[model samples]
Target: MRSLVLIGHGSHLNGESAGAVYRYAELIRERGLYDEVVEGYWKEEPSLRQVLKTTRSTDVTVIPMFISEGYFTETVIPRELGLGHQGPVPGEGIARVLGGRTVRYTLPYGVHPSMSEVILARAHEALPDLNPGDTALIVLGHGTTRNENSNRVIYQNADRLRESGHFAEVHALFLDEDPRVGTWPEVVRSPRVVVVPFFASEGWHTLETIPEDMGLTGEVTVFEDHPSGSQTVYYARPVGTHALVAEVVLHLAEEARGASERGGDEDRTHAEAWHAFMALAQEGVRLGEALITPHGSLYEIRHALDEGRPSDALTTVVTPEGLRDLTRQDEGGRHRPVHTFRNLPRGWRAVLSVTDLPQGVHNLYPAVVEEGYAHHCHSLRATPWPTTARRQTGIYAKVSRATPEQVEAVAKDVCSRCLKTRLWAGEKLPRTFFTRVPGAIPCPEACTYFIAEAREEVSGKRSQGGHDHG
Candidate 1:
């Protein structure tokens, strides 16, 4: 049997990226098509090197677990894995081949031929309570910054879906550029529309930003694009987890198997591999929010995630001074505290206006796995806060990637030692240092320092004598 290896751009904070890939791997293995079906990632565990070394299969098939085929498929994976050109043309493959294996790398699942059906299927599955006449189908994609080619994949499918007369109207929107969500309602003809994200994982954009802007209400937090109360918006899951994707991967594996059986000719295997890769590329699409890892710098992880190509979208949430100026004045006629502003230090404000929240049409993230997910504009804690937007907020953070032994030793120091007294320069401190400041950027630039500080504070105290330290 053939071997299948699926790789994802995973996240430590989001938990959904790896979870989606694991589910896909389990489905593929359950089919009994390959002698081995494995999962690997660009970030998190079961890394590229580890997965390859452990598989032990002389003949391997690698498929990028992504929603877009722009950079990761083109440059990053090949460069890092020593892969050459993917198809069957002579001298087209990468120069450095690893181990003693004859390998094949397939295109991303997004570009597979079977995706059209899958898209239609996903839409139908997400909106079971719908009539075609009243429903508008909007296909949302992570619009790219560096590559113009990324939007084409999503647009192609939206055009085809529209031509098929599947819904009241079919439109495509991107997260990166203009013709943004704020502008969507002006163009839509239908009174109600369902948006489906073409993303690989359920991360920040899908869970938070899109719904907040669109004014949607739902039950499951993971699937946040459904209509709120009488709100008409609807959302579907990312295309990666669709059932047809499994068939696409299996089909590519079968083609590769056929090439192998005919003869061990490198050209033939390469040719079949190339088609699969191309198909995968056509199906893939990406947006701006990226995966960051501690093993690499922000720039390095960005390169690893996008094949060293400059993104068409902004990499980080850089809230400029101009943007911060938009914060509303308090009822006391003050501009509010400077600490409430993000990105800036001390006291500054960024203010953005919700000028037009369209009624009939709504904005949504391109990739969502469920419908009826909900989020509220709440405070970071359950404690009530006096603000224009009032709702509870949850913080996301990564505590440790260090081994268990290292974590335990640090725990010991904090429990027993009165380490909170120790300061940056041996001065006294308050507990607020350990807690996050309200309205600040969730992750500081020096995230590593935060992790280190938390570990040291807890472990250092424990080592001394079970003191309730900060």
Candidate 2:
């Protein structure tokens, strides 16, 4: 009997870590794809090494049910299966001389483009009204700086989904990397949100860590009290647990069978594969700059300047003084408070000819996003704001004429005291520190320390908590 062993990064803490893996294994076994379909786990029994011994088949196919080509896929799996190498051969898919039987290892299923179909399905399943034009789809990933290659597939998939333009925005959020999952919501200018875990299986990260951090309770949950409306934040199941992944596994095994028959001459070694993947990733990043970057996106424009490649497309630089001038005289005959508009397309004209929001304000949205998913713009400055070009007026502002040290002291006090109290009380504080006066580039470099609750009474339009004005 040809044996198939599904290796999962089982959790000692989350008993459900291996639950999906076992379920899929049974599904595959019932199809008679392999005589024996058993699971091995790193943190659960039977251990990978021990499980390999139990496989009586001369032909054994071991699949790593992970989302990336990380340490687990390349190093740990080979070492455990006694493949006698630190690296794997990509596209070859077969390991010879492993415990005197032919072993085949498949590419991490998460990398396959087919997974996008499953993600889209999950989003649609959770939200039947999921509109790509207005909803932001965040593919939450387990990005580790450990191996730069660990998240290539994640970025690729995110971009892949973005290319479809299904959601108003599609971005990858890493638990470990910038644009972390915890605060992406604030940056997303969407009326609806759908977060799909890029993990192979449903476990603590998907079940406990994500929902707790996101202030979510269940799948297809609603994030009410949004300033905009009762917006929905759809939480989808892990991509791996999707029924289609079994087909990906079967496809990988079939490819391995082909490579095993052909004798592995054309395959690149694991190190070579990593290098190739890196080169591809870097090249993709280079090309990605042109397409996804909307023209008037000040964040990307600043990023270019910071990188020393200020784009010619960024000709209209709105300085701090320019912003103050714009704010002084408004069409409403009232001085409009500083608000922010981000991810603006190049062709988008300013709605209200107002002052230039501080450059620091541009950084704020990106910081919240780069930090991770947040409540759709949970108010740090005050409840009066808009992510869209539609600006809200008369936000209570506390500008500081004090020196930088004074500003820092106030910020420290608010951050240290009020933030701690709110956190301890299990209330979610805004994931960002406010640091700018509307329209004015103040004497102090960073001095907007508005440490109000996540929200205060704005008006009948919005309340202390709720959706952002997308």
For each candidate in turn, the TM-score is 0.51, 0.51
| Cα lDDT tens digits for candidate 1, 10-30 | 542333446677677768877
**Candidate 1 regions off by >4 Å?**
12-15, 85-98, 129-132, 219-231, 255-470
Candidate 1 scores a C-alpha RMSD against the true structure in Å of 23.1
Clashes of 2: 18
lDDT per residue for candidate 2 within 289-364, as digits (tens), equals: 1111222323222321123433553434445323223322234333211112211223211111122221222212
Q: Which stretches of candidate 2 lie over 4 Å from their true place?
A: 11-15, 220-230, 257-470
